[model samples]
Target: MTGRRVAALAAAFVSVAASAGLAIVAPAAAAPGCEVDYAVPSQWQNGFTAAVSVTNLGERVDGWRLTWTWPSGQQVTQAWNATVTSSGAEATASNAGYNAVIEPNAKVSFGFNGSWSGTNTAPRSFALNGVTCTGEPGPSPTTTTTTTTTTTTTGNPVPGDAMAQVEAMQPGWNLGNTLDSTGSDETSWSNPRVTEALLDNVKAQGFKSIRIPITWGQHQGSDHVIEAAYLNRVKEVVGWALADGFQVMINIHHDSWQWISAMPSNRTGVLTRYNAIWTQLATAFRDSPGRLVFESVNEPQFTGSSGDAQNAQLLHELNASFRDIVRRSGGNNASRLLVLPTLHTSSEQARLDELATSIRGFNDPNLVATFHYYGYWPFSVNVAGGTRYDATAQKDLTDSFDRVYNTFVARGVPVVLGEYGLLGFDRHTGTIEQGEKLKFFEHLGYYARTKKITTMLWDNGQHLGRTSFQWSDPELAAQIRSSWSTRSGTASTDQVFSARSGAVSAKTITLNTNGTTFSGLRQGTTELVRGSDYTVSGDQLTLTAPAMTRLSGSRAYGTNAVLTAHFSAGVPWRINLVTHDTPVLASATGTTSSFSIPTTFRGDLLATMEAKYADGSNAGPHNWTSFKEFDRAFAPNYTTGATTLTPEFFAEVNDNARVTLTFHYWSGATVTYHVTRSGSSVSGSP
Candidate 1:
């Protein structure tokens, strides 16, 4: 149902679509030998990244070609690690030079970026080597449901400026995994039926707003008519929030599956349903308090990778339709504040710009921009089983919030962190950690308050008990309240100082505070140790020797030989930086061989190694080959025969990373090498 609590990765499902206007042309079935899993890793306005993995369940073929049809007009832009060709709705992807061979029971992957017009739909079927691949088909067409509900327009109206209303909702909570449950029953997913007492408990804990993410599409028919039972149930729950003096936000939760985000072909259908849904909702709540806010959609994203321009246009149209439709519904809806989501509801600078640009020129004083932030992945959500939050993690989190503030809040646009919370899963007990989740809540609460951004904590019976109407851990709940309470007085008055470096030998940096006195001088969240890390003289800050050690990774260095990297598949790696004046190695082609490192300036010049590889496509996990940096005087030259050389400074090194390199020979012998790196040593055995 697109509930924030439900992990989308584990429940990844394929969505297949047949040509809307074409005859039912069944593909020819070849001998059962392989299976394929096709996926859309990402999508934007008019483009998307498509990936497919093929497993040789039978005898291996020297080469393979995977084919699929595009229901709407789509064109391939570029492909990596594979050769892709498209003709109308049909397209084929074959392996590149080094990935042509496959052994029995082995799997290979390929992917491409494609553009689309009108509507975008996933291929209904896929074929490998002219045979239909066996695997799960796409989501089937949902049945349309129709129901009629008695009209009721009743409730007191809220008063205040839209921004003031938003500010009033300082700390919020999401009634997640309850009414938004995808199961047949509300309690099927293990959360008890939401009760008034639960709302009371939430309010008692200092939460001022409750966001209800309801899946209207699931309860609607093909014609987009929402069943009366479902609509009334949502209204009842929202009523509870409003009655408890809580700000309420209701949105079209899981509308992507309904093709609401698809444009052109399904544009008409999508708009029709979207407008109808809001019209009905606005009419029902015509007399309700202004606290009952309407959200356009949750994570309103195009199905495939769509270009930003296309996504921006689609989002614009959808948001305009929402604002226009709801306003025309009369009653308190005429001036009710609305929430608009950015692309992917992401905190990315580019996506935020897209949203700001799309909604520019239109004067909507009663609107609040919203985006979701769970910036520290693997630790925020712990998807990859990581359990540490280091200095870098904290810096990233701060930087993300800083961007949002500068982009939206600073410019007079009120924003809300619609949904944010780290997963509570504990690695030790294999159960949700009520206590551990508090630390994250504490941090988020502090960040949100300082940024002056309204925040809604996502809960799905994980942190609080629904049946008992009590917190699973009262101390955890108390910690959240305490964090929020800190914002009761003055906000943090620390000013950020950038260590601008132009020359490699520059040691003194100036603070741009314009004579304003400030402390807590940090370089990207790493607070400088005054006497040891750096020394300040007036408005100038000078770096100490420890700063260089921290940057060069010298203190952590050891006598290790070569740093070898093995990729899951052949991927390009570019070393050295190039500018308009001085063009160095702009590109390099050795994926397995060692290279000569070059000197780089800290800020003015950067010798970077950027590897581009599609996650889970044409390659397995490339642990070490992600990104690396070397020091200014660092240079490493390793000989394949027996040579050794000099000790170089490494700014950062993912020393021990597992990489699987696949090699396909013209002689039909496929060889696989497993590479391991420790410190600077590179060793691999096939």
Candidate 2:
């Protein structure tokens, strides 16, 4: 996720009529009119964050001043995107220099964090430039009212059965980071514009659907009018997918965070903008085939709301409004599949239940429920020692799927795992080992299949090289494609280790047969006799000591030989025959801003690093966990034979405090090192 600045507000007070030529002096027939939306998105025990949006409805203004009185005594602590000052229960917010000019019917918004006591009731009335706001738009010459009338067109009719249609959309793919890029244009994010060849390749790759996420805010003007060129361009891409016989889903992507997130405080303005965007979209695609799906808002979440209850209600309003607008647009949209997501697209039981209630209330058979899964929280980002697809990680996956399935699928509601992949994969693949990632995908595919839920792979140009139209890791891709229909045989560990300096011993691996019959093992083209080289008893496969020694010829460091374990069905399992000994670390000294420990890997691979204080408390970044996040707090450079402690790690550590560093290797070896920070200088010892 990209870092977002914490919005703040500066203290300022300006008289509404003080500015020369900026006074609220309008003709008798055309007095200034405005709309104000006050929202409280986040609230804690005694403090909360509130957002205010003011729309100049009657006349254009070069400078603006808005005043409101809080029902309860609330003190503004901080704010952003505007200047805010308070006296007693009265608050005054004026536009900042950059956003001072508000065109007629255009909105400017600001937010602030404040402390409150007793009842924190929102102010019922607001005044902009000394004129009371009506909380509704006033007539403006630039306002263009669009009226949609039913028109017949030649195209495939929408399918009546939404379940069947969604079923056909199995194994979907997202055209991510392109249109959804929060930049000036689709190519602004560096991903090439949508091409027919791209859709062709996606269809050829066995994906039945493509989720083209489009951000409309960047291309929208006053009254949230989408640029026709951009709209036609989006239609062209959707047409390409539809022409290729692929089910297409287009959505309001980053706009959810851009403006829709302010719905709680700016309900009227947000809804007005949201409705306009959808009305235009629905009207444009009204004649298209039912294969086109409309997701109300991508991961609808609100700020300036009291809590989850308010957030849920806000989402329901948006979803309901979207459904109503689309249905009223006529044509095939009346029966088109409308997809809705839970708050933040979460698969939690409570969120699922909330969505379920809304679905039942809608009682629309053409609606589908959706959520996103990026594996478990820890394993998703390779944090808190979640470097492997262990039981905890696996359980998190299964448990999440089970909840969504039971809540939606079991009740005759089709579910779409809108996006699925490791969260760390977004940073770049290889954060998790190749084998662990493959296992995670394989399990997810099989489980989603069994649960009868369609899954969409979220690719932001990382998994698949968009230019080459090829997967970066073909082996992992093969595992994923194979899991769609059948289960694959996996092992307890993909690696078998042998000491580089000692006599080799027999190594046993627990195989997850997954209903697949085990065949003989092979090294390159030579097949090994089962009894001589290996023995399989039930799920356990053991390699003979002689075979291990021969595989590790001369006991070389690192991987000596690669063996493939063949199965009767599904993809073959890869076993790396590695030879390694305990790793060694040496003391070093450097400034607190940068530090690295010289390491002798001795063929071992670094797994995770743990930092702790003498008092046994977690140290460094993400102090709640002893194991610091990989790639963020620390990173291993095997090529340089060194493990680096990132500056971010040093930023939070206490000065003059000795922190214990424990480096865990993949081969079950642990090496301890200690580092002490004194002002800008740091020193380490093994």
Candidate 3:
């Protein structure tokens, strides 16, 4: 998927070359022998995703411009590649930015995804490389039309470059996940199965970004590690979204509290385990492209206020460690944009700075800070804001947005409004008064640009009542659609990217397996990319991609392995991988190698691996077994480490089909095995 693409809009230019005082005749057509073939999904033929493919019949083209007309009453709703234009019944095409040089025999394609209301016939007339298409003439060749009908669609995502486009192209939506499970649609993450329809609804309403807050309660019981099944479940959801062309964010959501709260005195041990978890997590997804992003941790909370700088210092301690974790992980994540949290995830409160400020100095070039807009937590809910004070009390709460965040704006720091909305659920609603909330949207957008910040809707897929301005609220949806749009024809450098981890430059990984050394580009957790630039290899993957204002990378699974990657920039870069599994063997950087199965590691276990940056502020334990649905042949990382059998932890195979097997490991320890049966348990192993 490279080379010239079609421009969304069409233009016409006639030349008049005359050395003498005489008008010179111009060619009737700009493109001479171009041809086009178009086919879109039945659901797309009319809506936003109008499929248009162009071919070169005569010369190869460096770029292309595709323009056509749908019958009399049809037109393009939105366009990309080239600008689109429409007249009464005619359509035309022209160059976009630079000239579309058509070689003697090559062609290219370009198009945009848009939504439409009523069904419209596909345009039959088209132009390519430098010629007209074979289809019957559609409308006149001059006047073009535009559609008013609205259709919502997800961006198309491919491995390499498409992910960046997806993030930039995606509309905003709220992350349904949080640290502590709220347990219901009103507060916490909804189950994935139940959330599918909600996602489709999101796309229908035209949203592109979704932040999935995850809690790594994987190993809640032991080894101070995360679990595999939990990570597997998260991966399942991420895969679905990426396959749907989505820009997703998977961060250490609730575990921030779990890791930070009820602190233990063994700080060094905590740091060691914490660092280990990140190392393992980073290695697992070493092959992921760029469609995915890694949000280091959710809001870093503190019980104390300005008086307790010590607690703040505790938060700051993670700054250097977190950076080392990411830079060492290798691949695009090296320089990928990593998101950090502030004191309590508050722009105003966090404004005091601590880890929020230190994170700014990471070796990685693409890093951003994250904050939430709870504004007046309990007050907004009406429960805390207090029942009186009329207008004055509300103003007190409102000043934070304008007064507090303004500080960060002054510092030129990039931030994302992680959580913010008028919570009018079964609980309360007072973040804003009335229509005034809409102003929040507009102001936020304008302010972000001025402040150079990014904002995400607290959430948009919640089942909270639609009557109020919530996830399901139609009014809220309308506000987002109206206020946030890239219709101005001008583009911004800051894009909501799917890849937020980092980048790699001439990356090479040396593996030590059976005393054999292997080297190549290290794979990154990034979920999207431009296919022409990178590829995956062996269990340890490597890649190098361009780092621009708009492209970044992140991890899919929470913790995996460590990688040593060299980039054109940054010295002694360090990344993090967090996992419960023990690394048996790997490279010096810890990116590639094998893991020694724990004596307790056994069963038809499912393992999920994820990567995180070393900013190691918040992380959790993870087991290397849980992801079962993935076809292992295609993606081996999903395979479980090992399985064991223990009476208390084992399951039955069947009643009559009992089979027995003996323990063969060198040592005797409790083994947890996976068993599926319709009836009874077998006396021994299957």
Candidate 4:
């Protein structure tokens, strides 16, 4: 996810361990009327950045002490706040200020930059204020360091050799009907359902890779367009893959025709949206480390794959477009390899010896060209009528793909087989019988590495042996078994933010298929919010925030706010509106959900729904993606005897000639409390 899509700000959160499958090895303990809850940055890799947070669990927690064990290989080189005293792998810290006593259930947070081996795990054990805390893993930590290399071509390549690198990460499995309805190519591609449970099964069996050939076009406009809703949902699934620490490959999938068709005639516009999509996704995962990648297009076809000339022409254009888009995104995306399409994007005689150079401007160091392998019709296909099975054909097919990689070695470009599968139009399960499939897969796995090529089997998950894809039989067991056993690449992971709908048409408030409203979510009762800058009218909410943020080319992450309902409570509701790393201010149990407010980023309330019937099951624990933060006040105006607002802290103030107000903290700290002349909380909370 890191790439040109990386955000200027870090991914934000208070306690993300639950969402991340992380356990706080030690839960905090406290005296009656006195409580303390602590947190680390949402990202806790084996890095140099050190951070810790302590919240008064009950009464005010004035002084604090924290202790924990660091992972063996990672050690702290520098630290701040309290002090770092370590022995072997254990460390402890004591707060310097007595007032640092976190007030009642109030919270105080701190951090220091550090480094690690790029894995997601946290420090274990902790003693708060000299008292042994209970949780094993203390808290979620923030991420440190971002990989930002942006070279598009290779550093060292054998001249005249051609290379392609497919982002082959999905495990090999037959697809189902839900994926492909037309019985067309879209059918059962890596059915997440079947493959979801079978991933470990396939990996254990020896399958090295799986290609989730998703046909997103079905969800797009008739013109083969992509909708934000569909994209977000896809991201959710991708998130699951990443969390599993699996090597995942996400591309335009089968919507090549629609997606490529939308590519701007000018590389700028196309690159703009290209970076936009990746940026949104990347920013969400910037802090989490992983081996996931974005493949530009499934199979680009500017011109049909009629012959070599057309194939060459299409590849040239795709190469140019792919490079242009990669360099614009930042973070890991800067240097992460991007897979480009071959001329016809398909393997056919018409595409013999066809390839294109790495496009310029994409010199981010990690770019790979790609082509598919299938050869001619009947020979390439597993038709029920095609004589019997052909093991030799399968081997040759694998060799054909190897040829594409050979091309890369000659051209010095990293290349991969974007796709390779066999099927006949005749019988549903006719093409490439299960036995032939086994041979095909065996040859593929054997030759893949030498060819220096990565691959994705057209393992559409749902249908399987029911149709053209026949991986269900005993003969194909090894294919499935091997795939179940042997995995490729690295499977590191980090959490990613997911906005229900990435983009919404301006002025829309339905929260229907297009609009993704933040509702049906809260720790206790729920409240409503409007859009980014709209006001709430009855049940309708609208937002009023600015379109752009201080961050360049990046708009604010959360666009909805509390427009309608508010929470009372059994459990405190966690909220997150800003997509970047979250900052912990103060958290308490007694306060109502309505009492929580916001800062910089804003959200709109659509409608808040809460069902607190005794019979109703509590959401138990949850996280809020709302954009809310408490407002901090400034120093008093000297001569005017009035607190002055600097342009830095200026509010539009609606030109009321500026009515004055005081700033206040919920714990009633000596801090001045204030209400706007408009009767709004200083933090802008209603």
Best by TM-score: 2
Q: For each candidate, what TM-score against the reference?
A: 0.51, 0.77, 0.41, 0.38
Q: Candidate 1 regions off by >4 Å?
A: 1-160, 382-386, 424-439, 487-686
lDDT against the true structure, each candidate: 0.56, 0.80, 0.40, 0.38
lDDT string for model 3 (1-686, tens) is 00000000000000001100111111112333556766655455445555555555542333344556656455444444443444435443433322345554454455544444566556767654224566333333233222101100111111233223323633456545432253422234432333455556555666676677765554443675555665566567677666667766667655555555323354575566656666655665445555566666666543333323454565566546666786678885665456666655644332333433364334233555566653333223322112222344344344544433433333344455666654433221222322334333433444444444455766534533223324554544554564454211101110111212333233323221211222222335443242343344542333343422222233332233332332332111222222222222111111011212222222111222121113322111111111111111011222543322222222211323322222221111112221222233322222
How many residue pairs clash in all the candidates, one count each?
Answer: 20, 10, 143, 175
Model 3, C-alpha of 242: deviation from truth (Å): 2.4
User: How would you order the candidates by TM-score, starting with the best?
Assistant: 2, 1, 3, 4
How far residue 278's Cα lies from its native spot in candidate 2, in Å, is 0.4
Under the 3 Å rule for N, CA and C atoms, how many clashes does model 4 have? Answer: 175
Better of 1 and 2 by lDDT: 2
Over 4 Å off in model 3, which ranges? 1-171, 177-197, 218-221, 264-266, 302-307, 349-352, 376-379, 383-412, 423-446, 460-471, 486-686
RMSD in Å for all candidates: 21.2, 15.7, 28.3, 30.2
